[model samples]
Target: MSRTVTLALVDSAGTPLGALPSFGVPEPWWQEVGSIVDGARRRYGVEVSVLRLLTADRAAPPGGCVSYLAEVGAPPRVPLAPVTVDLAPQPRRAPWAQPGGPARSLAWAKRELDRLGRPVTGVNQQRSWNLSAIWRLDGPQGSAWLKQVPAFFRHEAAVLRWLATATPDLAPTLLAADDTGRILLDHIPGDDRYAADQAERAAIAADQHTVQRRAIGDADALVAAGVPDLRGPTLARWIRDRLAGHDTSVVADLLADLDARMDRVRACGLPDTLVHGDLHPGNVRGDGRSRTIIDWGDAFVGHPAFDILELTEGLDEIDTAPLVAAWAARWRAERPDSDPERAVDLLRPVAALRLAAVYAMFLANIEPSEHPYHRDDVPACLERAAGLA
Candidate 1:
């Protein structure tokens, strides 16, 4: 599938230039802007950085033809006429969505890297959106990552620090972090293990179980570390409130049974602990021997089963069973009294509710243009929950 992007070029001063012809690229994923940037550089012979999405055409959630208002780092060296187009300021803005936000983030990363004596030699913006802005910074030593998250996720730095202290190897090495949610991390040298074998998947699941086990009785400490308390009751309230305004008439019966199902999940005896809210194979990075989990923006304190559900999300029943068994075995060994198998069964609908609430939260906070990224997520998850009911 091919995806295209139309750029409304803007100078560093936020002055509108002209619109570039809509360019097509093989990679159709809309949110991943690395290809879009590379395409602009390759075809137009100009360096451009995407600031935020302006409007999407034929966009189906994650991919399609989209128009973005981008900042031009330098004038185009090649003589290619860009059509005259009016560039108006976007009414809705996230901090990183603002024209100056990317520059400021880059400045802070450079300053911090300089302080660490690892001045940047090159930069590559891998992703930019409302949730986070990520850049790969290269220096004499190696590549490091500079990630700036929104205010809602300002707690990520603290969460990483807590993880470092408690379970050192599970998270990335934090080089430097500030109050603005910008974090400099030492790059883990490996491809994301999205295609790990069944044995490897089992092993990774066990490792996360260990991490969650360490946080078993430290709910207050985890909260103090800036992790949100999405324990049973808290998440329940969020689900109810999130689904309140939406027309959930079709799932009305399922919604009514939500509380009882959640209570059964609680009764399964799995203690609430640090849940890796978006735990999946794609988020794990390693070179066969060692593995590390990345992206803690969705981390929360919730039932341990939620992590298992996340880990085995897209797997078939045969493949998912072994991973879940390995994860549950560790927990059952740790808490001999707990019934993890039962918890996994009971938490299916609850997990769906959690996903719905989270996507709803994303839609509420992000700019309108970016809303398409998660617009259908709430209803899709609710429908899944109803089906699972």
Candidate 2:
């Protein structure tokens, strides 16, 4: 009835690890499946661990199931076969079809932590394009968050490191990083600003403005870190490409309308700068003293209004007027001769279209079987675009 995400583990020699010996659903299922890698290491001195999910199925056996393809150190002498898990796992779309996709992720986590001499007390798993396994340390060191990213997101760790150096406390301290898109950080405390008070909301806007200012000085570095320079026209093209996959007349009409605005939507004379791609309250956290922005996966160089518009859309009941006015004033102070209201008015339709197109991109990247959770998001974004238009 419910949906699930699953992963399969294979050793370096290309032998399957077989099914996990768990029966009850989701909770214990994940625990027992994790044990398979543990058992291999303890029993056979094998160093197998990393795993990431690949495909999802709404009608796969007992319930909606998603499967992960994993990799191990070497082939085991024991017999190997496919694993059929009948447990509910957290829902996610499979990003890659290649062997050892999400499967190898866990192993990497264990290896990295061991290298840092930080024995993990617990681990939390999340996935979008790749894996984010939050490691709760056993003692002393407390905790840290590690994110493994896709090629497009490879610069996140670098960006964090650069920001940590340039704007102390603005971003989480990047403890260490690798060239392959893996970054470790000291976790910052405090609930996200998603349901924050008015003052806290204002602080987030101010902090983000500061970040944008600093970002201007670090423009070349941001690009080197892998953040793309996306403008209205670039954004429009991407949106059009994504919408083209769908054949609905409404979808078609939406694209046509977007194309008409393409000329104006193209990059204008306004100075493009560092824009937090997903800057809702949820990504901005902490108290007024130290507002921390998390998740730089979508940071890019674009119109400043892109970030402003995103923040505006997420201010659910926190009185956006003052926040907008204050944030706008700061923006104008940063760029004299620019009007926030006028910028937002012009950016609104384009931003909405960009978001709608992004949802479509998410849909295209994921397995069709994983559509249940993601399908509605596309239309919702499209509707927002229509409303803005």
Alpha-carbon RMSD, each predicted model: 2.0, 6.4
Error of 1 at 198 (Å): 1.4
Which stretches of model 1 miss by more than 4 angstroms?
74-92
Query: What range of 10 consecutive residues in model 2 has the weakest lDDT sum?
Result: 22-31
Off by over 4 Å in 2: 1-139, 247-270, 287-289, 314-318, 367-373
lDDT of 2 by residue, 230-345 (tens): 75566657667777766435445556665555444332334567887888888976865677898887778777778877777855545767777787788677667666666666
The digit string of per-residue lDDT tens for model 1 on 222-286 reads 88878888877677777888777776776788667777777887887888888889888888999
Q: Weakest 10 consecutive residues, lDDT, candidate 1? A: 79-88
Candidate 2: RMSD to truth: 6.4
- How much lDDT does each candidate structure score? 0.81, 0.61
- Cα lDDT for residue 336, candidate 2: 73
Error of 2 at 229 (Å): 1.0
